[model samples]
Target: MTKLISQYTALLDKLDRLDWLVPTLARLSFLAVLFFYFWNSATLKIDGSIFSPSAGAFGQIFPKAAEAVLYDVTQLNIFQRLVIFGGTVAEFVLPVLIVIGLMTRVAALAMIGFVMVQTLVDVTGHGVALGSLFDSAQGLIDQRVMWILLFAILVFKGAGPVSLDALLRKRAT
Candidate 1:
């Protein structure tokens, strides 16, 4: 039992020596973005109007123009709701997988798909004219671009050195 404990301790020490900051940061950022997206999705009232009613009411007193981004009322279906729930859950779960370095590619791919669908919805449903080089659609474009880049990095890099995936791969070989 003592020997087994010692071996496990030694293994942990070796793992601690591995540089995990970069991957961990990436995973953490991913989680943060997911949280933001989920919060916005759950809170934002979609009323099929250019200006959100809630925002308009708030704007009257605040004197600041609310970012009343519009979405398609028709697209808000049961399946889409399920997708949003799934994506939110995935956002919460995938980061843990990424931090541990288990099935990193799969988690990254899932996130990528989630972001892509969101981007598509934003483009098609919202009045964001496609391929417009103007600053009018800058915010939407920037958000989508960032997600694309982040997912691409995760896909290409997998989890960093300190992940469980690395250990498993080492064991398999």
Candidate 2:
């Protein structure tokens, strides 16, 4: 029994050495699962240029306020428009950074913040349910948590050897 235990421990140690796979897989998964989702969303927010956000963009970011003004984005304050613009830009920029593994940790960290804000907007602005955690795993909260965890992996582990970050580090060294 002791010999069997030792063998199991050794195997587990070997598996642990593959820790680099975590961030690499996380980035790839983000590319596969969410890259286009954000790109498409950002596209929807723009009518012609990012300087001119669509009425739908205001509705999405500030739904109640947009409805209060009947979805006329011009009725919103400068700060509000800036928020919408910043969010739209982030939705495009952060995902690309993560996908390319450039400035990955910072990008992932920003993505976590973005997801949190997006979740808030989804729940409050859009009237989406904030569904309780551990209840059944079908709520916006659960889904966003998983997304955040994927970003968190990139935040902590970094984009692995396959990344532009890795290449830059090598060049610098």
Candidate 3:
């Protein structure tokens, strides 16, 4: 136990010294791949639509309300379609902002929101179940929790001394 604890402590110490750009780039790369995967799925129309079945039924039940939300004319199921559309937009926009380190906090926050909602939908609507904390799709989706935590760290750390964000901050001062 003592040996394991020491090993973990040593690892954490190494992490502490890593340049922020390394982690930032890693995070950006991860998000970029995720974006591509989701975008490709959306483009292929792999599913019936992006909208939830419940949402589509709701639209059918309340056409007026659906129309008010601009979901009336949708043929591919409003909820599913909207989800795909929203995801596509986020995939395109957020990664760019994150890669450039512009408004990174805001982008990370938005990403957290997106991942949360999608996870909820997948769990509740699709009947996806998680077997364990580390092996579940839920855990994978909530991996943003880690990213958000990292982003919070970055916000405090100011994107390190070499980032565009840091450069801008330096210039401002």
Candidate 4:
């Protein structure tokens, strides 16, 4: 039994030495599952031209605010436009940064925030009901919570040796 315990400990240490594993897995998970959702949503916001977001995107992000602005998204003030456009750009940019392991920590942190904001938007924009977190089945929060956990792994462990962040660190050294 002691020999078995020693072998298992060795195996665990070996896995830990593969420092890039967690970050890489997190990146792959996001790429495989969530990338298209973000890309498709961002595509909808754009008008097939640079930085040109549709009114619908604004409405989606800021439903109450959009209503307050009376649906004339084009007539939105500068700050409002900036927020919508920035959010759109972030949806496109941050994921790529995370996948490539460039500024991965910042990207992961931003993505965590993004997930939170997205949940709020889903509740407010689409009027999704807040369900009990202890419920037997999954809810919107449950799905988003899983996403947050994945992002958190990348945030804490970083992109690892296979990533650009690691490459840059090596170069610096």
Using all chains and alpha carbons, the TM-scores for the candidates as numbered come to 0.53, 0.94, 0.54, 0.87
- The global Cα lDDT (0 to 1) of model 4 is 0.84
TM accuracy, model 3: 0.54
Which pairs clash in model 2? none
- By TM-score, the best candidate is 2
Top candidate (lDDT): 2
Model 4, runs deviating above 4 Å: 67-70, 134-138
Worst 10 residues of 4 by lDDT: 129-138
Question: Model 1, range 3-120, lDDT digits (tens) per residue?
Answer: 9999999998988776465565676676676545644553343234322223322222122222232333333445544444454456556656765668988877877776676666
Write candidate 2's Cα lDDT for 1-173 as tens digits: 99999999999999899989888999999999999999999999998999998999989998889999999978989988899899999999999999999999999999999999998988777766776765745566887889999999999999999999999999999
After TM-score superposition, the amount by which residue 137's alpha carbon in candidate 3 deviates from its true location, in angstroms, is 8.8
**Which residue pairs in model 4 clash with each other?**
none
Query: Each candidate: what lDDT?
Result: 0.59, 0.91, 0.58, 0.84
Q: How accurate is candidate 1 locally (lDDT)?
A: 0.59
Please report, as a residue range, the 10-residue window in candidate 1 with the lowest summed lDDT: 56-65
- Give a tens-digit lDDT track for model 4, residues 1-173: 99999999999999888866777888988899998888888888877653776778878887887788786767777887787788888889998998899999899999999988888887878787667554626476778888899889988999878889999999999
**RMSD in angstroms, all models?**
12.1, 1.5, 7.7, 2.2
